[model samples]
Target: MLRVLLRTNALDDRVRKTLVDTLYTQPTNLAIGAITGVLCSLVAASYAPDRIFLELALLLTAIAAARIVMAVMLPRLRNRDARRMELLYEFGAFTYSAVLGVFAAMTVWYQLPATAQLLMVAYAIGYGTGIAARNAGRPSISIGQMILIFTPINVALWNGEDLAHRALAVAIVLLWIGMISITMTVFHTLRDSVAAAETSARLAEKMQHLARTDVVTGLHNRAGLNHYLVEYMSRRRAMPNLALFWLDLDKFKDINDALGHQVGDRVLSEVAQRLRAQAKQEAVIGRFGGDEFILACDVRDRREAETIALAVLADVTRPIRIDDDRLEIACSMGIALQPDDGEDLETLFQGADLALYHAKVNGRNQISFYDPSMSRNLVRRREIEAELRLALQRDELSIFFQPIVDLSTGRIRAFEALVRWFHPVKGELRPDEFIPVAEETGAIITLGNWITAQAARAAAQWPDDVTVAVNLSPLQIKAPGAAMGILNALREARLPAHRLELEITETVLLDHSKQTEDFMAELSAAGVRFALDDFGTGYSSLGYLNKYPFGKIKVDRSFVSGVNAGKKSDAIIRAVSGMASTLDMQIVAEGLETIEQVQAVQAAGCTLGQGYYFSRAVPDYLAGMLLARERERLDGPKRAIA
Candidate 1:
């Protein structure tokens, strides 16, 4: 019974908030009701002039005072403190209903002027509206309040000694029953509306959770980790002992490629389980993306954090069986401690990432802590990337050409264009300084196109026997419509595709698709010649030689750099030259700095050579001068100054 009473009385936050909002209109309603009561009292006094007259007037005045007091007090309380405010308002409301019930029964108990009945009817209409407004959300209160107002009226009507008065009492009882039905319906509608709102809010919260969670591993995704990081940093002043571990599975791609992604996914799930088991209840473990996880730990000392990191690495690398085969895993982790590495999340992540990179670069399957100087190289790289972007837009980048000589004839054959950067503050930057940076940032596509156009235009002015060679980044050919763009540039320059040689590495074919094969075929059909650049350096060199039909093979400088001192390089060069001869492919040996090195490469049957010994890479005008000298030699000249 106690539980039932509590359940009936309790209104939820939403309903209580609604009740507070409706109470703001109570003041005006009470004042109007008070005025109607005064008029009713006057009419009753004129009719009675006796015992009930003064008593009725004072009773109405008291009820009006109680209502007016509630009107003034109710709206002042905060909506959040709704239970106390609602109780107080309900007490005032009960009093008003009881007093008004007695007033409604006045006509049956005492003789009154006909106009006094009119006043009572008007007061009852206002009373019914108040019940609907206050008690719709609370059905028990509506029942009690309505009963208090109408019970006395029914009693006074049935007390009369006549059929007409008894019939009137029956009619009032029926009407009260109808009002009770309306109260129950209104209560149900309000309850369902509140329930639906609560349900909707809960479903929205679930959707937010799914958005931040990883589906496969069931760990916090990058978004979820970022969310925790923001909250953690916001209160970082209070909790200063924290460390983040950017954990990576070393050479995990090899597993995916060799065993398949399905096996890889199972391994990842097992890894997540191990991390969760190793992590403390307070530690946050998140999937940083594929094959990578981040562990955030709360520890006072760096040694404690390092211990935890080592334990996690040990657990991750334990031999685990997948597909009935036991396999060993390797993991690399980078740790960033609070305040020492960074104070902000982005800086912390960058520091941790750089540490992870160093761990991988040194060797896989190890742990490294962040040091301040570790970011100097990263900062410099970022600075170079930023400046390189501006270099392209400002036209501060230019092309330089190195001459490739026909060793058999001792004449200049073709020039290879190399990109050079003119930094105003740093002087000249070579391709070794910025070319890898350009490829990593995808700036090579833009830089490559510009060089191709420039070299093509310069080559358009050369003799038919001479050719212009340009190096293409792997990124440029991998792009969509890349071959078409190169074709368009060459066609626009009116340079025959035969006089243009595109140099590519064997690595380019490692991940290339049939589209790449189709692209090469289209260019080859258009008379665009190709050379396998840096040959014999890649693992799949001989395979690429058979795979791609090349007009030339440029032997990498590593072999030629050791040409004079070693017989292995000489034999390898001889073997490559022999292969090139059988395949009808021209061979160019680079990095000939000494007369002995030049003679070694020439004896190995290399068709051409390029090095500082012949001439370093120079501007377009200088290359044109070298070509003019070659023409003069072909025509009438005996010799020219080297």
Candidate 2:
């Protein structure tokens, strides 16, 4: 038992409980032990009753036993740990005995002769000294210490007188020990329990903090942001002008693709640091996910809001160093002013998203202010969204396949399926007129899936050498389960990925790092060809070419339009086409309306061209007729009649 107690750590709660329970049950055993000790003392004293020695011993035994029993049982009845309660009970027990012993010492001096009193004093002194020395090694200082110090002095005072006086003095020493024991047991128990409860409360608070704070960057996560947002918005009635700045890092995927994910995480940490550095005191910044972050602040004026936006743009655009490489990471910020954008959270959030889209469209790495025109765009988008749903149902939409030709060989390589909305009221609505709306409303996932399936089905009927190109919205790719949807669509259509080319805009590769990388890697591994569509429009074209895996780059219509105009735009076109060639990527120039535009693209070293220079986007039957005419020409006699 001693070995086991020595091996057990006292702080272990299980061991402590066992020790307390032992003390609680000790009251019964203590009573029997005390009675036995008293009877033995009486037996010895009966032989010398005149000496009064047995009476003194009996009195000491009875008082000690009664005090021990009361100290253990009282706290147990109160549901307290008996070990803790016993120490507190002993304090009072010892103090009371000290006063009683003094009173009895006076009585002993008055009653007994000198020798018997001296004997009583010596016994009391020895007992008290023994008790104090034993208890000093205990876990706490109880009433035993007071008994040790005072009982010895009281014994000396009584023992100076007669034998009768010695009996009273010993009885008083017993009473003082009992009183001290009770006080120590009760008070110390209360103190220990309070301390334990406070420690537990502090631990609980720390756990709550860890749950709310982000482990990596120490910023708030989506859950924490939502919690705080709800708390702040609860005071929305008083603070009406709450602004939400939805920020997405520009070309973040390109960085991840060029460097490893570890470096990408480092860049993200830096981005978070920049945000906190640039943020105003009132701003609450949090990571939404990947390279996306949110800045929520209560603003009262437009100028102040714009100032914050500019500061954020400036800070994020600063150069970040990872090992030896210094990278300039930029962000596109979209501002949605509250109550003006919407009275509620969801609508305001949508408005901010719309602004972000406008920022990327106009030119990324810049901030775009929310305007009423955004609402007009949203409305137009909604109408197109409604049409988009009904277009397939009512057969108002059809695929128009435009042939992709090799400029040098003049041979058809692929057919790009462009969707046209033949609106009943608004006749001949082109994709540009409605595709944005479809993407915004999250209907593009369905529309894009259909287009991929349709393109695959068409490619299956064509020559093995020819491929089908399908335009995919960034939003479609961003949505969860996107890769699964693409895979299932291809499998259902029974078309190999090699026969399908997915055209995605440069903006799609900007942010949403983890999602974009996963999607591209999965699809590319499956053998589907990808093209960087509308290049030279967003933040960085050359950077993307060097970063992502792409089969082709389609020059945006804006650059193509300017290729005919001046040296500046023409130089840009030439440089872009040359860059693509150097990278071993095919160049497809969009919006080739005239012979000059086509010739200019060809002059710029562009190999593939798609525009009205060939033919406008026509109906499916007309496109098939065009395909048939081209095939027949290839199979027919040579053009030279020498």
Candidate 3:
């Protein structure tokens, strides 16, 4: 039956091996059967005192000794050929049964004393029953042994003339049939159990695979990567050095926003394919969620890792065609080497992520290796982020106002509110030192709202003609209740909506979501004004001016400082000023420090200017005093005429 199952492919190799292992598991049973047979043979020989009886006893003794020896050696030979071992066990069992059968048949054929014949018959029946129970897992061998033991004894009785002998043969035939039936039932039950266990194991393995794999890109997810790392690190001594690479797609959010999520998914899949193509045979690649991929490979040194990263960069940057769009993408990579960067998965991930952040901050579409300084910088940034949260609650935050001057009359038209942090331990901190941290930690929403209310209250105290402009963070603009928050601030301060100007950069327009549109429209309908700050530095589009309610444009400092430098800055400014004029929007030239820059911007048709040449940002009290002085200067000539 076992052979048939194997040849027909009905039983798995593992399951067959498991069944075979059960045959030798009961060494105690083997020892007991051998000793019982030898003792029975000796008793039978002593009673008969015949040549055949003595020879049978000797044969039984030799077989018993040989079986005992085989059982003792089975453990050492277990790792050798499985089929040969199984056959050897079956041969020993069958030969012992055949010898017992011959001993029983000889007693019956010779018409020996009833007591001796009954003793031999009883021993053979008991041994056959033991075989049926103990070796049921392999029914073919066990049942064959039972047949060999019973058939000869039954035949001997049938050939005798005595009616009692014939009756005994009939009863033995019935007993043998019952034992075979029981053996078959037990074998079927064991085989079914093995099959069920094998199926459950296969299902569990498949479920595990699905759990570790990414559904979208068919790559390993974070859990799978962790599993691989754990297994790899366990055998690190025998393997080459490991290099972990963290990769991020540049401006991927812009693609998702401009196109759709469907396109974004396709782009991610294509990127994963490219990564797979470039990866080495020993490399393990995974998606770290959202436009980010992680790769770990065996490398000899940093140079080998660098070579792989460069090849990946080259392949990934190639144009990918999806539908009618030919999208071009770029990725930045960071590498961390084993032992040098970290010894564990979490530390390696952190080091590689820090290096990736550094690459992105310096410039995108580049590669960077982990450095100890990057970790220090990360510690510092974390400290700043924590301190900033407390700074808000402790009232360490204050606002400063920079005056915007009207170029035609050289009079202050408005003031742009800037936030300043007065740290108790570090003195005053610049916005550049902490704003990015605030943005990342989501502290900007509260901080930006506070600035809005403070700026509105200060502007309410200024001359009615002067408007105060406050910059809006992208997060703040997208935040829920942002429009209501701004309106509440104005109402609390008794400031007119038109007297408060909101400044936004091109980043805010990237989403092109209805929420932003409604936020701007809600405030604009309430008589509030909007300005496009840092223009010409980002995704500057004339469509933004038409699509949004922006009434003013501030040229970026880079362009303003380059004015009259015999570069294209002059032409760019002139072009922007012309476009703003045609659209009836005000243009402010920022970062003006010299008369030459002011003159150049004025020549380029800028109506307003802001920078150190005009006045540095000052506190609310100083701004109020400047406004009072400017009011007096304007009225001085009017009083003389009256």
Per-prediction tally of clashes: 0, 39, 0
* Cα lDDT for residue 358, candidate 2: 90
Writing each residue's lDDT as its tens digit, candidate 1 over 1-642 gives: 245336645656765566445544657765786767666665665666566666766776777777687678767655446666657667766766776677667765664555665466446545765575456666556667777777787787688777876776787677667776787677667666776777798899999899899887989999999997778666644345688899999868778877899999899999999999999787778999988899887787788888998999999999989977787899999989877888788888988898898787676799999988888877877888999999988888998999999988878889999999999999988788798778878998988999999999999988888899999887898788988999998999999989989998876777555666877888999899999888877454587777776889999898988544478888999998998899998999999898888999999989999999999999999998988877787765444433
CA RMSD per model (angstroms): 8.1, 12.1, 3.2
Q: What are the Cα lDDT values of the candidates?
A: 0.80, 0.70, 0.88
Candidate 1 error regions (>4 Å): 1-197, 210-223, 232-337, 350-395, 538-540, 562-565, 630-642
lDDT of 3 by residue, 1-642 (tens): 557445424566677677777787867778888888888778878778578798998898898888888777775663756567678888888889999999988888987788888888888988898789778777778888999899999999999998998998899888888988888788778888988999989999999998898888998998988997788777744446789999999989878988999999999999999999999876789998999999988888888889999999999999999999998897898889997999888899998998899888776899999999999888989999889888988999999999999998988999999999999889999899899888877899999999999999999998899999999998998899999999999999999999999999997897587889999999999999999999987698889999999999999988877544445888988999999999999999999999988998999999999999989999999999988888789878999999
How many clashing pairs in candidate 1? 0
Model 1 earns a TM-score of 0.63
Residue pairs with clashing backbones, model 1: none
| Most TM-score-accurate candidate | 3
Any runs in candidate 3 off by more than 4 Å, and if so which?
Answer: 1-10, 111-115, 236-240, 249-266, 317-319, 324-332, 360-366, 510-522, 538-549, 559-585, 594-605
- Top model number, lDDT: 3
Candidate 2 lDDT over 1-642, as tens digits, reads: 234234332444543554344344546554554454455444444444355554465565657666666756575464666456546545544643453344234334444444543444444444343344333223233334455445555565566546754665566667666644544444335435644776787898887767766766777878777777777777634455888998999878888888988898888888889889888676777888778888988877777789989988888888999999999887998999877888777787788888988998777888887787987977887778877898888978778788777777667778889887788898988677787667657888888888877777767777678888888888788888988888887888788888888888876876646788889889999998899888777465467776677989888888777544556667887887777778788988887788887888888888898877777766556666777787778766665432
lDDT of 1: 0.80
Question: Lowest-scoring 10 consecutive residues by lDDT in candidate 1?
Answer: 1-10
Alpha-carbon deviation at 25 in model 1, angstroms = 19
